[model samples]
Target: MEFQGARNFSIESPGNDVFSSKYDDDGHVKRTGTWVTASAHIVTAVIGSGVLSLAWAVAQLGWIVGPTILTVFSAITLVTSFMLSDCYRYPDPVHGSRNPRYMEMVKNVLGGIQCQLCGWAQYIILFGTSIGYTITASISMVAIKRSNCFHKHGHEAKCHAANYPFMIIFAVVEILISQIPDFHELSGLSILAAIMSFGYATIGVGLSIAKIAEGGNHATSLTGVIVGEDVTSQQKLWNTFQAIGNIAFAYGFSMVIVEIQASYLSYPILYYSTQDTLKSSPPENQAMKKATATGISITTLFYMLCGLLGYEAFGNKAPGNFLTGFGFYEPYWLVDIGNVFIVIHLVGAYQVFSQPIFTLVEGWCAKRWPESNFMAKEYHVRIPLVGTYRVNAFRVIWRTLYVILTSVVAILLPFFNSIVGLLGAVSFWPLTVYFPTEMYLVRAKVPKFSVIWIGVKLLSGFCLIVTLVAAAGSIEGIITDLKTYDPFN
Candidate 1:
């Protein structure tokens, strides 16, 4: 978890090739990542199931507030990302010690309670994201079935498919994939997930444009859904709050910025050189900043297109998930393809988010029970083509239980938009806005009561308020949905 300074490790190896070609100044493997690679990672991380709710979010806030909220959240993510990027190297931006993990950076810059808070916020968000992904993958699976049903039996036929079975199937897949060991093993999966994300997003945007081209007028307004005609005044207020949460969720990728930057380093070795060698040019912080800007810009553009165009296509009645909500029933094949892409993307994405938690808990258990075989033992199992595999009983049982728990939670609360909104509202300010701002203040030593200080504080305060109300609204939405619904029905 912690990286000692370069001076502590012995870098002198018996060969010139190892010293010259393999290691960096910091004793870790040489970093080969560029801003382009980091941007690609960010794009993959930032765009996920959250984008599916944007049209519904836009419908809630209407034309004026909808796009504005998206823009504002985008700006907030970019600014905070820049702050966290600079924190990657401490004391000095170019020459200071590298903090590869987010918690490590927080501990170095803003230790004590702040670091603990960051850890809690980060892990909670990751856990909640697993549940959200489960619900999303199931919905997509059901959508695929429903799309086929609609195509076969006419669009008017009943095509109700329970989400529970698909959710269980997805959870079973995750339980098996969860044994992949660590993040280093997930590089190919991450790339494929990123591609799938783009595929589905493009499909969504293309479908929305096609819907718009059909020239069907969708009633929309500057202020969102009308009170009497569409929703009650109370409902409108709650929905607006929930919509803000949805946007917040869409922009919630700040927690992993440090990890993404750290990923630039190939894998750490046992020893490092004592002498200061040349580092990757521009520093990780600088490259990460560029990546953050580029990635967020691209993500926001996609968000605007998908959200605004989908809103234009469906107007105030845009379903929480436009693809699965039957917004475009004619192109059944396209819808099915989009849903399939979603399921594939979420499969990889679920692992990406959940691996850290697995590592954290498993590491803690190993430390706590160093002498126990249950925690430290590995069993080798040989397969036909996969060759030998190492499996631990503790890992299998613990990870399986974790997957089952998340799946059960998803089954209990299957409201997609509401769950997304709640998770976003719960995490956005604490992880995205407040911690990064505080860390930046400590790192830069900005004078108290200065203009920058006041502005950031104000921004953090406003976001906290947004978080509170958004949570309230999402909770209300869930409660409203629960009234007429039965769990496991």
Candidate 2:
């Protein structure tokens, strides 16, 4: 369908002149994305490394609180996502100018120092997520090798593997994928990553079911791991906080929702030939809300399955990452396959989270030095099978260094659960709850001191407390891990 104000332009036209007619009303390349592609992108970003930790989260919270917390977080995520989606366009959700990035939306809607705060929260979360994904990817890679070794030898075999080498390998892969340009070019990769996410998640659920059917009993209770027997009182409190953080991490795709909603491909000229008779595509906010609902529904289902079934199968002993943590070892091949899917999904996910940061830095540099060819120049290199490729010196160097830096960080502190918890705790309140709620209040013109306003503020306040406790727990856990851990060993 053609956009309402879209102009018909010949596709053969060359140079910048084509941009005026070929682009959308906001000067972006025409957005061809529907709710389906949007949902794919959401699923790819949301159902990632965080899902692997849900089993452990559940083990800490126990069966009742575990499922309840997961459901509550899912509901919170859905509400906040809908709020953020509406903010994609400015004054009017339907007709206002587009705010393609999250910070852009914050700047336009909230303005002032709020934008700077949003930038720090958003970019730090994105950067930390890249590191977390790197750590998780290397873990999965090591899991595959160890799984094979266990099958060849026995469960008693050491089968030890170093995560550093695999981390470097994963970083190299990300450095290559990082050059893909922007969110507009990530549709295919996101779709593939979404599928891979489902693959491993399904494998994890299936293995959990198999293990449960085997009828072996495990230690379990309504209150989770016993404080006196399994852990100390302080440890219990800390673990509960970390569990909350893990759940928070699993539901955090809100930061990128604006970017995903803004992603659009150019429509073919043939289809737009009869522009007068064509209808505009569905409004972006509407599409994003639908995608959020669908994606969250699908992910929450998998999360419940993975977390609940995994808990039932392994009880309080559930590993942080059920698949790679060797919770299911007999079907070693299936475990290996699951790890492979994790690696592939993370490769795509790393790009999804990193692209916005790349855009922000690169955009800032270009604006700062418009005359610098080193920052703005594009070198075209054509391979036989592939079409012409645009290579920028600054992009190549900056993104490569960024990947390397994250890789080194992952190597230095390779605690997966703690890192995920810390990132989630740091980002969840500000990015997920507070920003969206405040933005919605301003954009929707919610009356001051009204019931809705008070309720949202209360929600935000409660989440702030959660963030504090979760951050504390994650930090404590990291400190504990570091005591026995040797960096880069």
Residues 61-149 of candidate 1: C-alpha lDDT, one tens digit per residue = 98899999999999988998888877767888777887766677788999878789888888898899899999999989988988888
lDDT of 2 by residue, 1-489 (tens): 333333563333355466655566543466566678777656655666778899899999997899999998889888998898788777898878666667777899999699999878877887998899999999999999998898888888888888999999998888888876666666777667768988898898898898889888778789899988989999999999999999898887665465544332221111111111111367777777887899899889988988888888888988888888652378898899899999998897788778768887999999999999999899998978978778999999999999999999999899898999999899889988999999999999999999999999999999899899989999999999999997766
lDDT of each: 0.83, 0.81
Clashing pairs in 2: 31-264, 32-265
Q: TM-scores of the models, in the given order?
A: 0.93, 0.86
lDDT over C-alpha atoms for residue 270 of model 1: 7
Give one clash count per candidate, in the order shown. Answer: 0, 2
